[model samples]
Target: MKRLVGLFAALLLLVGGLASPAQAAGTLNWTAGDSITAYTSAPTTATPGATTIVFENSAATGNTTGMPHTLTFDTSTEGYNHDVSLNILANPFDANNGRHEATVTLTPGRYRYFCSIPGHSTMVGEFVVTDGPGPDPDTTPPTVTAAAAGTQDANGNYVGTATVTVTATDNTGGSGVDKVEYALDSGAFQAYTAPVAVSTAGAHTVRYRATDKSGNASTEGSLAFTVVEPAPEEDTTPPTVNHALAGTQDDDGNYVGSATATLTATDDDSGVDRIEYSLDGGAYTAYTAPVVVSTAGMHMLHYRATDKAGNTSAEKMAHFTVVPAEEPDTTPPTVVAEVDGEQNENDAYVGRATVTVTANDTESEVASIQYALDSGAWLAYTQPVVITGLGAHTVRARATDTAGNTSPEKTVTFTVVGTGSDACEVPDTRTTVVIDGDDTGVPNADTGDGCTINDLIDEYASYPNHAAFVRHVETVTAALVAGGTLTKRQQGTIVRAAARSDIGS
Candidate 1:
């Protein structure tokens, strides 16, 4: 028995020695959420090798709106590496739960990446991959140096302020410098990306160091400088601010359509810091753009400006009159309702019905649309209404104009015939609940896939998280209520039951 055990252990060791080693994967992570203009974090430099790319944009990462963003490598742009084809669309609701990864081999070059979504032209960056580690190891550290720049006074002290800049250089045939760090007055060291500015009226010391990609760190270097306060100037004059109104005027000196007011301020000694304006004696607010007044009446706009020297200009007023357009809009909006779906031989919809309400007003324009399903209470309509229950349905819709005129109601009727297998009966699970003011069968879960309540709830296990599952339940229940499949009370009961379940959680 001992001989047999020794022989087995030797065989195991031989097998382990002969096995192939796993490939080294270099990981590069990126994040973008709640922003349309730029990525929250991105990689600027990487080493050439088998790279694992990761991109994430999710609710936990700060995307509350569930907006999608794409990270697409530029293949058509000139002067960029196109070796790897990568395009990833990420959002909180995507299939991969807003995180995606891919494996690719990277070469030494500059790769350009950007968001392909329209109106996101500012989201662009470059990834530079350096050459792989050479056969000859690099052991030489990088050399760091620091310098100060400022106007010197008679006492050799800098005038007003001093700027300190650091530079690092690697030895010949060595790994490139990775990062530079600096410390102020023996404080904690921080990654240095820009010049350091010191304005205090005293002597200061800046210590800096650099590290190379090969883990070689250079010796710390230091730079000392002194700053002296500059003489102050006296200017008590306030800034001058003026306003001008621009618009087409009628024969009676009344502006037609609208009037735009522009405020201009100038200060010779101290520059203007801010400008504020008030319309119709209202609260003063910061002025950012030209204010346009289109109301059909006379108006007064007040404006003032403040300078950096603590001087404020007196409030000035501009008077103007704006008349309405030639034609008045007193007509109500025209509305129509239509039912659309896949119809069977009897003209009844197959499983579901869709109702669309449209309203148009060329004069004042439609301001809102309201719809009532099956003589129920009116609800604000933002999208097409979908109905799904085996029964006849009626949708009544109306529109309101910007002038507050309501249009006459328009009605559309439709029938929904189920496939006889879409819905299944599930037992009530909750011990105490109320639906439509009745306690009987209070928490029954309806299914369209012929599954039990638990089975149906477990279907959301494939989602990103429990919050996403809850959101889907809310969305589906709201639609069911709109379609008359479930009453508002029943929908609330079902949603509450789902939320209290531990299936997705």
Candidate 2:
């Protein structure tokens, strides 16, 4: 009997040594009432190892049949694990008030603890398992980076298509990166799965962020960039053309002699590539310098310009005429005379006479007109010329053209009779005096009688001084008759014979 008792004591000591301490597992306490389900003090975080959960029922203490309740643990909400469920507690006021205890091995993860009994699922809580002994909390958020490959212009604007890539990283290795999201132009955030393509024009904004598996989110990061339209598909506008010239122009826009037609072309988008021109509706040719148009008469020129982008300008045309040099004038002027007076049968004026001369020319205007009386110096003729002489008078006129050509002299004759006795006096004439018989000495004698005088005048009436010469001849003839040299009839016959002869007086 002593040996058996000694053996039992030794066995008791060994069992006590094998049992674990009450504080070895984390304590999670829960309670249930008449119709309510809740937890007194449940642990939110536990070390990676064994965890203890204590449940108590107190419905019977309230004077009503206690409802049975159960505690369960699961990897996800509403996914209860039958193996981790605690035995049901039915008695409310029994010893220890239906108290129960459960222990479970926990790894590093998040878990859900709730009652699996009908109508008790509402009582739930969260459970987190971590490394042993005051493990560090996941406070560091994830970092996100965004990059793009696109062309940049001088203004820092992105041109053409761009590929945008986003990446996320976490420093906490326990809960790595969860997900990365991005937003464009304040739009809604979307999960970033692949590279994004940006192909629009103008400015834009991008926002990105990342989250860690431990529910830690990073601050949003922003990036600004501009997208410009692709270089305008080959310039399509044509070049402009300008033309200039240096020379004298006529009323018809015509230039005389040689002249240069200068052409200039300009383009706004693309530089001018070439210039072409055509003359008189002829074939087109490239132009390098000013064109020389030396031909006379009307001319038509067609020109155009093209840009480097293969754009051609509308055809432009210009018209001009050229004149030749002037020639010299060689035509002489014509002169016309006008007389203002009454004329006799022999073209002798009975009263005062006025004469006017007019000159005209075809090629050049008349320069001057000159007039002269018989045997008188020439004078410029501004107005009409008046002739007041009492005998036959002569007038001469001539004209000169602007080209220095002088016309032949033109002459006209007119006569004026005065209202006096001297006006009847015969004009001076040339005649001879003769005697019928020889008279040695003849003193002053009576001239021939009136009948002899009349015969002498009638014989030499056509002579200029016939009347004067006739009187002298009569006197000489009478001297001879008085000296007994000739008879009266003979004297008259001798005077008439002298007037008929061409002898000196």
Candidate 3:
């Protein structure tokens, strides 16, 4: 009996040594029907490192012929055969039926427990391994940071579509990050699977948060950034260009002299950057001010304006001309003189005569007309000139233009004769004489109007009565010296004529 008691105690010690300790274990219960679900009061947490899991399968019905039930624990959340099984039962009455136990070495992490039967992974529960008492439960939420990748404009707004990348990290607890969610502005939250695209313009806010496996959610983190829609393709339309002039132009678009050309540019979108212009097909230059064109003949001007977006306007053209200054008039004027009266056969005038002078010019108007009689000073001719001399006389005329041009001098010669001299007979028995191709009578005393010393001298060379002619001339000269009607030159001529007639004393 002592030995038997000793043997029994040894058996009890062996059984106790093989049995699982209840201290480092977790009890989980689930009823398996068509699926598997956790019991109402199943323990969800266990001590870390070498924890024994106690599972109860209270499967009462719904087990088919080929379908079986088993308890499995693994890191896998799906796929029945992929998990490590703790215990499997072919039927509810089989070994370990309705109950299963497993000892697994686990770290501080969450694991999934499911039925290992085909199509039974959907029925599952979670088992968490934790460090022994002391540390609090995983309450530290994950931190999330969101960054955008894109260019920024001068206004500090993001240009175009920006790629928002969200990164979450859990550093405090063994529970890892479950998911990261992001919301744009006040919109609904969406799970972040990849980069988010933000394309709206103006100010925008991106809110993001991370939830850890322990159901702890981080405080909402937000990034405020401005989004701009690329500035509408950079205002591709160029500025319109218009050309203006500061002076009048002729019918042929010719300017009389110098003129300034101004360019005006306009843009409805982006403002004009600068204006460029070319003169007379020359190279292009910036248009800071108006351009002055002074050359003569045809000229061409090309201009264009560029906007801030680097778009250039279509080339514009303007045509014009500049005329040269008028030259000074240097041409001389022409003078014309005329006499108003009939002349005798000897080209002599017997009565009063009138002489008129006129001047003309092509470039400038005639300023004045000057006339001079024989051996006389020049006088301005305002009207016709009258001549009453009986002998040959000459009148000189000249003209001047407004440009200081003097015309060549012109002269007219004419002689005057009495009507009584037409007959070759004396008025009252006077002596007759022939001179050159004319016949005239000489006065006996030179006191009458029938003849004069001039007539005697003129006919002395052609007279057949040379002695008579000389006597008559000498008589007339003595009478003229007494009467003072003849000058010294006339007296000398008469003396020479008397000598030629061989009657000089």
lDDT of 3 by residue, 395-505 (tens): 899999999999989998766545665432443333433233333333233423465444434443344455545443544454355456665565555456455544322
lDDT of 2 by residue, 86-117 (tens): 34342354444556555655557666666665
lDDT of 1 by residue, 281-364 (tens): 999999999999999999999999999998999989999899986776778899988888899999999756778899999888
C-alpha TM-scores of all predictions = 0.29, 0.28, 0.34
Local lDDT at 291 for model 2: 94
lDDT for model 3 comes to: 0.65
TM-score of 2: 0.28
Instruction: Assess the local accuracy of residue 426 in candidate 1 as a C-alpha lDDT between 0 and 100.
Output: 48
Candidate 1: list runs displaced more than 4 Å: 1-253, 256-325, 422-489, 495-505
**TM-score-based ranking, best first?**
3, 1, 2
> Who wins the TM-score comparison?
3
lDDT of 1: 0.75
Each model's lDDT comes to 0.75, 0.65, 0.65
Clashing pairs in 1: none
